[model samples]
Target: MAHPTTSVLCTELGFEWPDGTTVLDGFHLAVGPGRTGLIGLNGSGKSTLLRLMAGELTPTSGTVRIGGELGYLPQGVTFDTARQVDEALGIRAAREALHAIEAGDTDERHFTAVGDDWDVEERARAVLDRLGLERLGLDRTTGELSGGEAVLLHLAALLLRRPDVLLLDEPTNNLDRRARSLLYEAVASWPGVLVVVSHDRELLQHVDQIADLRDGAVTWYGGNFAEYERTVAAQQETAERLVRAAEGDVQRQKRDLAEARVKLDRSASYGKKRAVTRNDPKVFSGKLKRQAQETAGRVRGMHTERLTEAKERLTAAEDAVRDDAEIRIDLPRTAVPAGRTVLHLDHVRLPYGPRADLELRGAERVALVGRNGSGKTTLLRAVAGELTPVEGEISTPVPLRYLPQRLDLLDDTLSVVGNVKRYAPAVGDNAVRARLARFQFRGGRADQLAGTLSGGERFRAALAALLLADPPPQLLMLDEPTNNLDLASVRQLTQALAGYQGALIVASHDLPFLRGLGITRWLELDGTLREVDPM
Candidate 1:
């Protein structure tokens, strides 16, 4: 039996995909009441662990125990569009039962169904209001709500359950500034055990501690994301210093071994000369020679052992240092000269978003931010020519490319190399592969199918295709590009964008990423597009 206070406990937990890919082996985790930020790289099994904890998946080998009722909000909050918001909130039955009794049905079943949840509807409504979804009435169909609204609705349903344990995966992926703020408030006040797997720094700021899932294990860090960063930075600095010291030790060992060998050879030569000059008897001379040979062999063995130990230490030291690869590519063709007209929007009105006029010239980098359901994605689609504007003139003097939030640019059947080739048909296979290597899709990785890729790998492939397109995008637009990406991958993306010389527009809620882009302009979409201070 698990401890009474332990909200969740997994003992000797292990899981493997049907295809024989092992995710976790002998993994043991115990989480108590409080918010824990579960962080890791995209393919590091954070979602898998959450699924196991939520009972959505059965482990191949061990047991999971929960001390209380559990609620889970998946990364993708999917439901039938025809379902009512009340049904989606898991309160339809109780609400119906209460209404029937109010209407004098006089059925014992209604009373039984209502139980102690007579105020279920009110509680649900309050949760919705807290999550900024009060406008979304219970009578509304799920289809009427946007993606962000669906996510919040799912969270509201979970909150209504009021479980002792709550697990949320990428909860803030599609949320905008205001929605995220609302979520932050909810997380702050969560009394039960909460484990959230996310890359959103703001959301992570509310965590009581960070559980970094790396290399199939959990390493706990006290405090929130900022403190975790500081701790890891300090650790890396120490690891690097150890690596340097170990390297020096290895070099010294090598030199000492070489010198020992030279001295042994010289000593043997001198012994041979001395024996020949002394003209000792054959038996005595041969015995002395054998002894000298044995001594030399022992000396050589000792030096070799010392060298091997030094090399082993060096290897361990190097392993301690993080070698996360970065994307570094030079695209001279993507550059847009100063005063060049990249994009122009003449009184453009988005379908459900904003009505605005804008002109982007030269290599200006723009950050587009807004509240959820404010139509940031809609405006990007309109600019990308995916959607017809309500009424306006939009012109692009140079070639452009848009990376949507869904990342549907690549054909699932094609490999990463093939996808890039499809975009840049004129480029040779070898040339494409060479460029993709810079994006960390090296060798066999470049040959993997797009459908088989993890979220981060797929993002990288899509980004590579867009940037390496035939004409090279002079006006590049991205919608929530950092979603599903790990912190390291986010840094890699930031580095890649740093090398871009074209006019760039990114619609994202990631303040740190936007700030890192050296954004020359900041625009907010409400009812209209307006300039905001560079944040």
Candidate 2:
């Protein structure tokens, strides 16, 4: 059971843009203890609402109340290039406090300020161990750590603060399978209030409740993402039925108004004829005209009311069930000769800077599965011709598209359109625009700077460029293509790949994703690459 004190409440909150356009209105959310997942499509005010909860943004008209201390881990953290993990963990502060105590300078002021008298090194080591960084060198520069490692370190630091309420935004974005599992385990065991925003279906399944943000309001559900999805489907069906019924009512009302208008017209013509006859004709005509006018007014009022109600019903139905179009890649057609081996490695081995062979592989849809720094990415790069082989003959087709795990191919300085045009000139502007639209970029967004785009947007941009290239490659190599992608986008990519007729070598720990794609074979990269049967 959750404690009553550990709760978050929002009341009739609203937000508007600088142009007086509403982004979120009449919003209310109640988050109780236990893990709650926040979900929505991009630009649906999920982030804005999170900021409001964290007290980083003020609501325009309503109040947000958090019952306890709040701690937040933003979507991504900025690491100090010069600092190491130990430095980031406040080892210096710990050391200073320790030294003061050891020097027999334990004044009340110093002791109160320091808070502890334990060895700083031991404390730091303990914290690092809990975060799975015990073996990592304290002196290692932060700049040298991989993106995934950096994220873990930042998370460890945040946990050290021991906040009562933890707000995490896409915490699993760059994490590998092992790291993600560790994070899930930690959150599950935590006793504080947790509000997380993520699109990973697997991660979301662990949450206690799902708060779906759509059309500027939050809908609460009692189960995981799958349950929420089912609920949404049912609600959408009901809304569609209501909308259709409303339309029928509107049509019926229109017909009734038309009939009434016809009756009034007939009555007027009858009165006009009597007025043309003689004696007391004016009085009779006036009475007939007054009755006609009254009928007309009633008919008009009823018609207006019916139309307004119908329109409102339709709008409500549309709002209840917004369409999320899965992103589909329009891969350029290419001629890949059948039975022509696209990639072959004969007794190939991966060496770590003059060390013995670390991993070996053969031709297959080999999933390099391991923890971070397990050399999965290195193997992919070696196959892609980016890294030279140390001891074997590696052969691949001339044009292979390699999507790195971290989308490093994008030029940060270039605009989205510029990058596409430069890398894939054969794709004309119109075609490029169409492809971008499939990925949900439209209007001026297609022209925005790539550096300014969000993680999801950047992934879409990279995929767009890959598909637009002239002479599409026969072999598609991807390292964790599902990372940071929303569920809908992942489905889109999976569907596109399902229809693709090419060799694919992907390294991802997303077991469900790999199975969903129906990968033909598996290559396990542990010490030596060996073919393993898929589970």
Candidate 3:
């Protein structure tokens, strides 16, 4: 159903928010065949651009020319949980018709539904296999699948459309390692024009090029995310060096201009004394003074121009340098002595999932890795006292807190300070304000409603509540802490975790992030928890 043009073009594209916030200004882009990875910070307009291209949003003052059929998979995919997988794939009617004819129920309407492409079921299964969903039954309701599985299911449906242009936003954010591998294979085999907006480094590595959106502009880099990172790293290094050279040049120009002025003053004074001592003619003395002033003005102007140019160059160079600020915090009284037993679980059993025994001593940093539905989240919830084990003896020597993936710990309607105060009722308003400021919520920012906060801000607010609790949780558990976070925010979280002197068990699929946390133990949950070598 696609035209022969097979190209996507945005000519002088412009878009703006209803609140008078300009998201994109005069952005132009031309995308052709092959996979293109669109990447940027959390709010760098990557999603906005995708929406514009998908025709879900109309550009305020530009034209979008798509010369082919399109299919879009949004960041948050929702489906009718009651619908079967076949229904979700848009093939239930065709499949039913095919089965009806085989059963000898010769209805003319059923024949029409079959059409020419009678292998809809085969094609559907193939796509599901490609996306690691072959194990999921076509007749099963969508509610039966896990969160990661649900995301893969939607992607499978999109791929079955066979569109000339495919737009995906953070498709791999919820996928596990195995599912990610399958998605990577699909990307590698894709032949049409593919454009995906994602922060997953592994997923971006499969792209033919990377489109970096920053400051309302798209900068193209050849090759994948790795190549983009290398290119930017090289540029920043060169930029920093140029800045240093420019600064030196400006200082030298300033010194030269001052020296020239001093010489000119001395010359004028010497000429005046000479004209008076030699009894020179008045006209000759006047001409000499005029020449001296003219020459000094020219010298001063030249140096001033050089200094101005140097300053301009310096500013441009400095702009290219990265200035990622680190998060710093103090977690007082959250420390556990080296020999203390922080947690002990004896034959702990969840209502569903593997029964296991575990223990945490002192300030051990544990990395919990597992596939979706493997009970990683359930275990964390049980530890946080949100859920009780069906049967087992679990003991905790200190206060514990859990940060779920949804970040529902804070009330959206309340201010960030109000949420933190809920956990620390005894702490006065002044003390709470002081603590929130350390979490980067200073003054009026601390008074902003949790619902109005950005993704990173909301995460920080939820974390602050846990940290400022009355008992000061000595054991912390986080589930997919880096999900949907920008790179800078991930770094900020790493820095914040570095300051927490407590027993930590973090369940996440981000291996790089777990390594950054300095994890002392690695636990994989399949049917049971087992400590494994990180390598």
Candidate 4:
């Protein structure tokens, strides 16, 4: 079914939190039918804009107009564990009504409840199957599903409604490769106004347009994520060139201004000497002094005005060149010597999933891949000593650190620096703050409570705490490390990891993120653990 060329419009939209924190001020955007990728740094209100468009939130001022029915999926979706798959699909009542009608119920209410959805259950099943949820029947409870499966289920529910305007927020954040491919197919074929907020580059490849939200404004581009990158790169290069030119002009103006001042000073000195040498009329002497002062003032004002204008131009040019910088820090003590065994798992059996025997050598990067519920996280926790193995003998030759998916490694009551300092009790406040600065939490930001920070900031804080711990981890274990990171934060993580010379084992579904780390080993966990080719 093809939808109308309906569009979503925001008429000078303005939004703010309850506590008077402004997010968007006089923002305006229009999204037409077909895929539009919404991208921005974390805390830049991309999610908020989607919420507003879906009517999940009302703008503080201005208007949001959608031309058709809408469906929305949030970044973190929550479902009741007791709810069955049918309930989660939002068709339990309708299904029950249809069954009653077939059982010869003469009540008009049952027919009313069933409405036009006579084949609702079949349609639900088909959509579920399309989204790779056929393995789990509709009678199964929500708790029986994995995180990625649940996300797909949410999307499936939205699709079942056949909304004309679909809004998905971070839809591919935790999906595996296959799940992402399915989602991409759905997005590519969607006929309605589809706006997706995501940092997943591959997913963004299916978009027809890219809308970038930054500093409370939207900039539209005419193509997919790759085209947006190329266009932005070209613009940035031009902006940087203009910045350099403006800087040179400013410097030249300053030099000219200084020369003008010198000439004015020399002229004043000469005028004074001439007046002393010539015993002319007092009026003539006064006129000559006035003229000299006027001429000097004119020259000084002209140069000063030119210099100010040049400086302003330089400032504007610099502003056009985005100043977003990635995190760069060194952790040399984390280096491990070649051939040193950093970890050894002798016939380890997971409590719920796989069994394996493994030996991890110095500075080896490993990618742990599998479907959801395959126990990648359990294996990591066991290796980190956070969980007791059902049957295993594990040895760690060096200090280790574990970063879980939830990133609950920090105390919410404490500040970021406090969290790092707690992990490294021997480290002083100054040292901790210095390290936090490298993580991009400079000055007062280091003192913000962990509970108050945004998703990206909290992840950086968690990473900083883990890496800055005492003795320095030579073995770092991360579970779904890139789960909710925006593109900038992901790049920051990559930059920071590039400097850490440690053995890393990261369980993540993001193939690009894994490849970015330059994985030397690939291990897939099922009921059995086995090594797979990295390629």
Candidate 5:
């Protein structure tokens, strides 16, 4: 069946703060009944516009019209600790209400009399099956569920509400590859109007259209992420050409104004001498002065107009290249030769409850691929010397750098540059500033408190500190490095890893990223670590 006409229209929308500061201005958008991917840099008003569409925030100056009911999933979910998966889905309440209505015991004042025919249990089951939670134990506590499982459960609950439109913000942050694939599949088949705010390039490829938000305005494109990128590149080139042309025009205008001023000065000098003389020999001195003044005024006006035009063109060009500078950072350099044995594990056994053992090694770029709490991070910790082996001796080399899944090594109170200096004291201030510049931390940003930095910025700072040590690490260990990174940063990091010569042991569910980095070995963690042939 065709989907309903669920759309949103925002006309001349303007949102401001209490201090009379405008964040979004003259923003016009038309959201049709299809998948629309919203793309922007951080703090670009994507989240705010989504909330406005969901009716959570009213626009300060314009109207937002929603054609139908809307379902929203914010960047994070707040779970009720006391509620189970099923109870959170409202399945129990729906069941009881249906039962009461069918048994003719429901309050007539509370429920409409459309009662006994409703198949609430069957409907709930259908929705659960569609969401891949049909076989799950509904009474399982929310606290016990893994990150991906909890996300799927909450999504199921939201789908059960049957809203005409759905809005999701960064919905794939903690999802593994399997979970992400499942989500994309579900959203692809969903029959409602969907607006997604995300920086994941792969996810954006699945949408029908892209709405790029930049400079407080939205520009629509009729294709996926790849097409959008190509269009933006072309636009940047055009803007650069315009900037050059404007500069040339300004230079020409300046030359013309100078020549005109000289001519006017000569004319006035001659006219003044003629007026002072007793013999009125000039044909028309008054006309000559008036004409010189008009010419100078016109030249001045042209100069002002050319300068304004040049500045406007320069601003456009700068904005076009602003987002391109972020993906240029160099990864930590490692001089360790390739194919060297950085670490080895023999007969290693890690216990899980009572009867399981997990083994891992540094011989492969192993992806601890499984649901959360499946000993992936635990295995990495063991290799990093953060956790001791319970039975066998785990061999590891000295001068190894381990980037934990969480940036716990960074001191929150210290500035970014201060943290780097403290961690690697031998690095000079100038060298540290230069390295920070590669990571897009120039000017006063390096002096900002580490706690105030965003997740991506913190990750960059931590990586900078790790790589800038006196002697570079011979082995590199990273856990979920791509978790909070935007797509461009991930690409840049992957390229840098491809060039690194050190031994690598990464624990990530990002399959595409691993493949791009030329990971050649695989270790599956079941009860033991057994090497498998590379894919």
Candidate 6:
């Protein structure tokens, strides 16, 4: 069904940070009923756009209009620990009023509060159940839930609202496979307008359309993520062909202009010789020379204009081609011998999971997969020495580093280069910069503050720091590394990893990325770790 004209509309919208960094300018968008996947590179204002539509942010210029009530789910969900589940769902007052009426306390205030939501409790429970939160009673505190559970609970609240328009930003970043599936089911059945900004390919597959945000403009494509990819591939092919044609045109124009100049020179020479041989009157010769010069001027002007237009066309065609750089580096120091044992775990018991044992050797790559609320993060933390195991032993004989999902390892006050220096204090400034260049942080970008970097840039900086530490990590543990990365950046990361000769353990829900890693083993972490062929 077609939504109202104002379901979610932005007219000449613009936004800029306090530091005068423009996120969006003169942006115009109108979304109707159906799912739309808003995708863009990191720092391209996907999240900012969602905030503007949800009224969490005011645009610097223009306007945002919503025809009906709107619901928003941000990347992170924060709430008071003591708040009850019903309160978070926004049905506490109505539920309380209904309870009072049931208890025979027919106060006028209670009757007024109950109003039209007499079944608010039942609806809230239904939403919770749909999101796999059936065990979470209305009395449960927010603090009792895990990170993934908290995100799901917030989404459940939004679902209960039944808004005319809903906005979700990176909704599946914290979710596991099961939680993601539940969310996808909910999205597929959404009755109102839905807009999602995410990097999760699986979630994007459920979208009815793709809205690609690039260079401050939105390009709409009809169909799911797969269809969008096919369309973009075809467009890129056409663009490359156009670029080749434009290049040929410019070359031809240059040749024509050169030939025209030569011809004019020859014509002028011939006229001069003929004038001398015929001994024409001085006035007639002068007029002939002036006329020849004017004709030459017009010819040159016409050729120059054609050449200029051809060059302009070439530039436009080149602009249509994307040139996103990839990460390429050699990490010879990170290599380990085939028989080297990087990590060994003997009946390790984590805080919330069962005992597990593991032995990693050489440059083996392992993928850790599990559902939400599982102890995947916990296990990685224990190995990284961030958390203490309840029982048994864990050992890492060589240098190790962990890149957590939050990416809080780097100091915000330091520059990108400075952060790397912090990790590899012995490396010289010039050497550090040369190494960072491989991560795509060159020149002034290396000097930029960590706090000011975008999501993708920050991830690159963190990876550089870890891989280039004082004693290069032989065992690198990454948690959801592709969470906020654009497709181009993800490819860059995969290419970078191809050069790392170390034992790698990555915990992620991104199947495509794991498949690209050439994983030697896949371990599913439920209560215990077990080998599984997820592929």
RMSD of each: 1.9, 5.3, 3.7, 2.6, 6.1, 2.6
lDDT of 4 by residue, 328-347 (tens): 99899999998999999998
TM-score, candidate 1, is 0.95
Using all chains and alpha carbons, the TM-scores for the candidates as numbered come to 0.95, 0.77, 0.87, 0.94, 0.73, 0.93
TM-score of 6: 0.93
Models ranked on TM-score: 1, 4, 6, 3, 2, 5
Model 3: per-residue Cα lDDT over 417-522, one tens digit each: 9999999999999999998887788898899888666566788889989988988988999998887676777888898888899999999888888999999999
Residues forming the 10-long window of minimal summed lDDT in candidate 3: 1-10
Q: Tens digits of per-residue lDDT for model 6 on 1-535? A: 2245548888899998776778889999989889999998777888889989888888999989887888999876778899999899888888888899999998999999988888888888898989999999997888777678988999998887888899998888878778889999999999888999888888899999999999999999999999999999999999999999999999999999999999999999999999999999999999999999999999999999999999999999999997788889999999999899999999999997667899989999999988877888899999999999999999999999999989999999999999999998988999999999999889998998898777788899999999999899999999999877888889999999999999999999888999999999999888998899866
- Candidate 4 residue pairs that clash: none
Candidate 1 positional error at 17, Å: 3.4
Which model is ahead, 3 or 6, in terms of lDDT? 6
Query: How accurate locally, in lDDT, is each candidate?
Result: 0.90, 0.73, 0.85, 0.88, 0.71, 0.91
Candidate 5 wrongly placed segments (more than 4 Å)? 1-32, 48-68, 76-83, 95-128, 240-323, 327-333, 337-341, 351-374, 385-393, 404-414, 418-422, 425-431, 449-455, 469-473, 495-501, 526-535
Q: Between the candidate structures 3 and 4, which one is better when assessed by TM-score?
A: 4
Task: Order candidates by lDDT, high to low.
Answer: 6, 1, 4, 3, 2, 5
Flag the better candidate by lDDT, 4 or 6: 6
Q: Which pairs clash inside model 1?
A: none
Clashing pairs in 6: none
Error of 2 at 254 (Å): 5.7
Looking at model 2, residue 15 earns an lDDT score of 77
